[model samples]
Target: MSAAVTPAARVERWFFPLLPNSRIAVLRAAIYLFVVVDVLVMVNDVVPKASAPAEFYTPVALARLIHLPAPQENVVLALRAALVIGALVAATNRLPRLLGWPIAVGHLIWVLYGMSYGKVDHDHLALVVALFVLPTVGRSHPHDHRADERAGWALRCIQLAVVATYTLSVWAKIRYGGWDWPSGATLMWAVERRGTFLGEHLVHVPELLVLAQWVTVAAELAAPLVLVLRGRALGLAVGFYLSFHLITYAAISIHFLPLVVCWLAFAPLEKIGQRLETRPVSLRRGHLARRAAAGQAVAVVGHEAVQPVPDPAERRDA
Candidate 1:
């Protein structure tokens, strides 16, 4: 019998699974869409805050490191304009290399400038990586749905970033909240500060809050398993993760849409794209058999192709 696959081999496959460029392109489009939406709609409050008194400008680590100036009204307006316009241009994916890097840098600056007031969100970790990686990868084509290692590499980076976002969250709890975080003190504090309707009621159950704190740690730590999961297993993991975010939103006022979109890294988006791109049943019946025959011819050359369902007549002939 052949030797069993090693853990290293499994990890290699997990990070480097074959995926179509179209899927990567689709993911890029989705990420860009969310970035635009966040700047335009969701985080509109940040724009106004940029005009806050220079005394209110409290820079984060990155901003301090980069020595970003205090947000003057005109400066903030210019940065905001650049970020929004750059995001719009990048979303179109025309001249990605030209627009992508500037957009990525501008976005980081925009987020940092806004975050300078006080709070800094970690949700955009994967988004930052996604924007940078998109410019590096070759443009994905529609009809050319083939497995690409380069495309997979870019996606794998985002996947690792997403996983790190969760797994590393535990470290933050330990560092700041300390080992007693499971005692529900942090939850109590957070709820007291900004609890929503669900959080308000749940605050009464300290024991349940304690249980939830531990559960969050467990779930976040288990996030890396999404890489190893396949097919239905992956779908289940996706649902669980999505539900986790939804529950957080329902209970607390925190939103993680940036992180949520990054979970597309683990999704079978290529298959979804294939399904959506599928021709109509009647049209497919007429043309698919011919392509199937041609595919067989190409397969003899050891070229792989995505096969559609065979027509009833074609199936009967076979």
Candidate 2:
């Protein structure tokens, strides 16, 4: 007579087979790329003009929000540097639990300081929400391969916020620009008025302009539903959103880091991590051989040797 395999054993066999892969490595690389690009763009835009007359900060706005006096230019610059360091740490998944929240908060403060210069835009709001919520989520360490439950929740929250941004924008367009938003020339005029890189060129191609306007409306209107779909569907939706942002960047010169970072939420980061762990040299050969020998020795006693389960989740977070 034989006993059935335990549920845990069955689960280990089905879901966590031992195999070498590079999914996590790829995802980590992607994250690093995004962070590096963001940092470069920020430096190019902010550093050269930091001391210019137009780059001044206003104290009244800070007092209105938190009832505290605004710091001087030197203090703000120091905080901005700290914020960049924190963002880099978070992107690398180094000391995530300890550094994530402070980095996020510091980013918010830095943005607020920038906004105090009599200039604010809708694109900046997404970053604020992302920074505010990132600290409450997962801790990425070198040894833990499994997704932290809190981190997963944090990603989900970020997704919801992204969806809301699109939904509200669509609503505003309809309310303020009217139902003719889909077919009307309002979006075209708005882009033209902005006079950004692609805006003038886009207006020159009437057919392309019409297509862009309609697609923007369609994408924003469907954003909520698009976010609800998981896995590959979500991936596609995120790609679409990325296209939207890229187009905006080209056309309107908008600087929205959160919209770009949101793409990470759609990526299969956990699966990527699992693949990376398995691709390295296997130290299990000797152990497996010894175990097999022991099993053969036990066979004489009328019992089979049970194989050990592969637990990828046990690996540390990268």
lDDT of 1 by residue, 205-306 (tens): 977877888888999999999877888988999899999999888887887999999999877667656666665644654554566755443232222343
Output the number of the lDDT-best candidate.
Answer: 1
lDDT score of model 1? Answer: 0.78
RMSD vs true structure, all candidates: 7.7, 12.3
Worst 10 residues of 1 by lDDT: 297-306
Full-model lDDT for every candidate: 0.78, 0.58
1-318 per-residue lDDT for model 2 (tens digits) = 889999998664533333122323333334444444544454333443356564354634643678544445576567656766666656675665577567656555555545555655455455556555555544454335553445555555556677777878888878877877777775577777775866887778767776777888888889878655867887777887887787787887764665666556556656655555655524444555466545432222222334554335534432
TM-score of 1: 0.80
Runs of candidate 1 with Cα error greater than 4 angstroms are 1-16, 280-318
TM-score of each: 0.80, 0.64
